[model samples]
Target: MDRVLSADEIRWIHDFLELKDITYYDVQVEIVDHLASLIEAKWAAGSRQSFEVLFFEVFKDFGDHQWRQLLGAKQKGVWRQVVRNGVSIFLNFFTWPLVAYTFLSFLLIYTFLLAVPNAVNYLQESMYLWGFIVLVTWGYVIYRRPAKRAFLAYDGFVTFLGIDLYLVGWILPDFFAIFSERFSATPNGMLGLAAFYSLLVLVILTFSILMRIKGVQQFYKTYPQLLITQ
Candidate 1:
């Protein structure tokens, strides 16, 4: 029987991947397991190769790109997952009991803006307020959260979620100000497609944050190390 890899050896593999910038925990873990299995198999084949020798051989199999392909694969997968999760969240609001509340919320927003003497002015200001609020709240959450498992959030989905929110919050008002000034007079230019897309992005970011928080339980079930019990 071949000798199994030690804990330190596994961590070495992780560090190697990290050095290659494969920092996402999910991607790192997957690749580590794969390399371990290959290394052990090589060892069992009576090859007198050291860990470094075999590690290089395995890594080289993925071409000169190192871990970039794997990293890209994980990023792409996470993006797809984020999109799917967003769609599900979007649909949930328009279905069954929540639909009524969603409608009421829409109506309230519509009424509040329509009732204002200068609706566009209020909107421009409100976008800034909303952006500021989003930036502070999410920036605080990300700043305070322990980083031991930050890699777990590195799947790119949650990271991008927070990033998009922070950016949207910081930039939306400026965007609205510019767009409303230049294009508001045009027949179809109430809010450009860009602003409309930004609205959908905000919705995705909001739901993505919620998913990541609620997702902690699911992840913790699989990776108990994620839970920082104090």
Candidate 2:
């Protein structure tokens, strides 16, 4: 029979990882599995060393600088997943039945601009409001589910949302203002610009909502215990 780590030994591994500051469950889990495999392999090879000795022997492969490099690499990978998920979610709005709703939303905004004299001002205000909402949503997530922060995926998603806050709240509005100004001299131009901005804001807000909800749900589904405790 192959020697496997006992439950206590695995718990010890978790503790060691936390002590080493690899506390994110999403990242720690992979390292734990790899370390477990290496330790078991040593035991199977007829090494008489204790678990601590075997662990240090294997960990020595990752010197302090190497460990930091590994951590940075893992973080970059997690953030890349965040970007991929965001792109996928953004693309879904343009496909199938969702595309119908998307067009309807654009048309409705266009019509609304045509009907209201001050709709452009309202639209700008709404963009700022949505920016505030994004910040609040991000803050709520941090406050309500601090445990989720222990996940690299969740952390990456939250950071992505923060970047989005700056883009939607500041960059988008400035761009919309400049774009509207350039086209205001043409017929139906302001209305068209406002409508486009509105649709864009809608799409971005939807993307942010879906990203946060999906990310949180997936993490909880995978590790329900995190929810039960914190």
Candidate 3:
């Protein structure tokens, strides 16, 4: 029979990971599982080496610099997954059953833009509101995120939020004056364009907020031990 690691032995693996600076909680989960499997395999093979010895022996097989390289690669892969997930979720809003929400949002924005005295200014204000929503959503995520335990996916998603802020808060506001002057003579045109842009901003902001919430739920679900009251 293959002997499984004792609770203390399992904890030793965790401590080893931390000692190696693999601090991201989610990343540690994968490496810990892999290390456990390797250690158990040696036991099954009739190796009587102690747990600590087997741990290092297995780690040693990865070559002197290979373990760090492997960790770096995994961290990069996690960030890529984060971007792919956000894009997929954002695209879903424009498809199938969710498309109705997208349509209605556009209609409502167009209606409001038509009634407003200054469509451009209204659109700018709408962008600011969406930007604020993004910030508040980010704040909630930060509040709920475990202080001592970090997740690569969660950190990657927050980085996306920072880019969203740059676009909505800084980039859009700067070019608004130029665009507004060009469309000044065409209020109808301005209203349609503003409405479309507003809807786009709204959808992007919604994506950021949803990504943060879902990311938190997922990490917590997978690692309940890391759960903390917000």
Candidate 4:
């Protein structure tokens, strides 16, 4: 003889749906209640069936496939909202400052390089050392926080940009050296070159520190749960 679902069985279904995490709470509750009603109606029809059989039959009509469709719809709605909000946020908070900083920093670096051709060689070597340090530090930080995977990935990209800055600082001097040796007199000789490269090293170090601070701040904002441990 088929058994009717007990109160415990109904509660089990509700808990199972919750643990699955596929559907929203309200939707999962609705789905579970709907299934329970359908199963109750089946039992009321005088059918000889096990709870397992009734569960399977009802679930087949409202299981993974239906859940997948529901989840997809939910995700699409969330993404649409995200895009709408993201556009306004980027315009107000991020876009212009980022553009202005990038342009001005680039302009200053270029002007410095053109103005002091002789210091290029030492600056290049200093930059290479800084690049190695940044790479190693970034790798360590990312490995230490594997759980915050998305933020780690973003951090890694920023770390790479830091390395790029170091590389450019390193290469600019060497390029100037080759040009001076091949084409014309170097502008600032050995002592001046040392000072120039030292300045480059200082700038790179400062930039790296600033980037690390920003990355930490962003990581905290992105994964506020991480702050609990701190």
Candidate 5:
């Protein structure tokens, strides 16, 4: 007499495929149902065959090589979707807020620097020195942990901050003119100070850009199949 498979047995097979990672969850369920129906039809012939024997026969006909190819294709599709979703969610959560915060930070720092009459004063000079140190430290951190999510957030923060500093430095002349008029400094001195500030901004921007580019390249190299595996 024909042997029959219970619904629970079908579910078990599906779970097995999932646990083995032989197929994705959705595909595993579908494949299990289809195979079970095929087995049922075969067993309805009234031949006394065991479930294991019937299953392997049906499975072998699926063509091991072809099934592997199909699984590989499905894995690629799933991984791409995973990576795309992760990046989309990350950008949604952090992009705009980071940009706004970085812009405000740049404005506050530049305002303080402009307000200080003596740039050479210990406090003023220390601020500039610490700012430079922070930028370099961020660049190094990104370089070391290129593939981490934290690194991506840090890079975005630094890039926007650098752009803000660059813009403020470019417009320093207008602010310098007002300050010089009140303080009685020559335009030459104001121009010299602005040039130095612009140069520092440029250096920071360049370093940030270079570090970001290199870090991205390294991330891809380290996880070449990260997108496909996700």
Candidate 6:
């Protein structure tokens, strides 16, 4: 018969992970299950091993990076999933009222561009403000929210937010400007296109954060013990 791990024993193992710097909730859940199963097996075999001894032994098998590698793995997984979800959302915009809305909005903007010389400037400012707002909001969420759960999703958002800020505020604009100048593209046209894409990128990033929030909600539903009041 396998030995059942006590609550205290399980908590002790969880603390050991924190000591190893594996603070992310998802990683904690994985390593805790792993340690419990292995420890139970060893206990059933009649080996008198201390939990601490077994715990360090398990961590030792993971090499020098320790449990920090777990964070990297979780971050990579979340990043890919967020990107896939964002692409799906973009593709879905081709359907229904979304398509109609997109077309009408572009038409309205184009008409305004013809009438208003300053329209491009306003659009560019809006794009910069969009990126800046999201970056700051996310930064504040991470700062003010006491980290009681996995930071993989939060860190993942911050990582892409940095890229979005750079792309919107500088890189993409410069790239498009270069191409526009080479081909003698209209300044307004290039500015409009750049702003449109920058806004699109921000929308995708916002949706990705929404998905992450939904995942966290589901996690709490599944493991009520892990739920922390927001």
Top-TM-score candidate index: 2
**lDDT by residue for model 2 (128-161), tens:** 7787778777777676455443777667765674
RMSD of 6: 4.8
* RMSD of candidates 1 onward, in order: 5.5, 3.5, 3.7, 10.4, 13.4, 4.8
For candidate 1, the lDDT comes to 0.61
Error of 5 at 79 (Å): 1.9
Model 5 regions lying over 4 Å from their true place: 1-4, 11-28, 44-48, 90-98, 105-230
TM-score each candidate: 0.66, 0.76, 0.75, 0.35, 0.36, 0.66
Candidate 2 minimal-lDDT segment of 10 residues: 221-230
- Model 2 lDDT on a 0 to 1 scale: 0.74
Itemize residue pairs with steric clashes in candidate 2.
Answer: none
Ranking by lDDT: 2, 3, 1, 6, 4, 5
> What's the C-alpha lDDT at position 183 in model 3?
67
Compare the candidates by lDDT and give the number of the best one.
2
Q: Which ranges of candidate 4 are over 4 A from the true structure?
A: 1-124, 152-176, 179-201, 226-230
User: On residues 146-206, what C-alpha lDDT tens digit does candidate 3 reach at each position?
Assistant: 7776677567655664766776778766666566667645757666565556565666667
The models' CA-based lDDT, in order, is: 0.61, 0.74, 0.71, 0.55, 0.52, 0.60
lDDT of 5 by residue, 77-196 (tens): 545543454455435534676556545545554454466566424332443554565456556655655342222222333343454344333443444445444543554544444444
Candidate 1 differs from the real structure by a C-alpha RMSD in angstroms, to one decimal, of 5.5
